[model samples]
Target: MSADPGSPSAAQVELDGVERVFHLGDSDVHALRDLHLRIGAGEYVAVMGPSGSGKSTLLNILGLLDRPNGGRYRLEGRDVTTLSLEEQAQVRSRRIGFVFQSFHLVPRLTAAENIGLPMMLAGIAPRERAERVARALKDYGLEDRARHKPDELSGGQRQRVAIARATIMAPALILADEPTGNLDRSTGVEVVRLLEALNARGVTLIVVTHDPQLGARARRRLLMEDGAIKHDTMAAETV
Candidate 1:
């Protein structure tokens, strides 16, 4: 889809003085220190960093999997840091999508069942759930593999299933952690193209990757060190 001319370029994610600290014995390890960031809707952002630089920590906080010891996180103009555990879960389920390095599909479930997990947890009716799952299977090129388990699908197919599951709820923000890390170069490229297609459709895409090649594809790149954003720059039309 083409960009919407009238769509407002507004802040979708806002972070201010965000701090995360892990206490180990008597020592406190600062994972994120006074981090401040703002991301606009429909923006494709990539985060690159070395190991132990708190890349995972940032992603965890953004996904609401971990809480900051200090500061505020405002999503779509509402503060989420203060929300209770259940309240935060509700927001995370509806407003955010997560794609991990591992294809976290249930081994016991079929491809179609895995893709429809979110709606099932959300308590959607059986008929509508079946219809949406059918469309998702076709949309993600898993129609023939609908009844197959994760072990039965190829690596790319597994990642595709994971992607389908992530976006099934139509979340506004997608947090991808090393999405292509598990695939070969060729298959990784295919997986990335699928992600880019979703970004083009106006979802906010943030990818955390160690591969410079993958990071360069994003319009904006963020370099992290010591849990802080060291560099933020715009790349050329490398996509």
Candidate 2:
């Protein structure tokens, strides 16, 4: 559970009549169909569905990795749907963090280095990068594994590093797509707790998962079918 039941903050995400279509061999695949959704600041949301249902497409649009073919998307009150590619990239770098199923850590980089990658890309000074990375390492309990590469770390440690890296930019929104897909049940539990801890600190968390048990833990659950949300409900009694 993330956002409080009576949150006063404005919406962090807003979509109006959103549509996404992919053209494949003269066939139009409607990935998202007139979708409209809003997530308030600090909300924790889980999107769930079968493989072809469009949960990934919706997450992509929210993360600014994919643009919608039609309709408006406002992120933090700005019209992101109309942003140029460069502008969108800038926004993404500054305000969004992404966690993927594969962990997405650079194979060659040490855990500390990977955690600091975003700041490095943004041209942060070395001292600042070092300070932030060190703090993140401690925050994620990765100090002992700082020098380890992704291959050297266990599944849970790697995911912790990925999460550290994702949040090092101080992103307002964290988009996790199947974050625990590659991990065992206990490790997945650890990762989910880490995500929820960040959410407790007021960062908006949106996770895409097929696991029903995991989805039930969120304050809000959305079920997608046929490129649209079939169900959207807040927890009556949080699990």
Off by over 4 Å in 1: 1-11
Each prediction's TM-score versus the true structure: 0.95, 0.95
Worst 10 residues of 2 by lDDT: 1-10
**What is the Cα-based TM-score of model 2?**
0.95
lDDT of the candidates, in the order given = 0.88, 0.88
lDDT of 1 by residue, 1-239 (tens): 11121222222899999999999999989999999999898889999999988899999999999999999999888999999999999988877888888999999999999988988998888888788788878888889999999999999999999988888777888899999999999999989998888887878999999999999999999999998999999987856
Cα displacement (Å) at residue 213, model 1? 0.4
lDDT of 2 by residue, 35-62 (tens): 9898999999999999999999998999
lDDT of 2 at 80: 94
Candidate 1 lDDT score relative to the true structure: 0.88
| Candidate 2 clashing pairs, residues 3+ apart or interchain | none
Query: Which pairs clash inside model 1?
Result: none
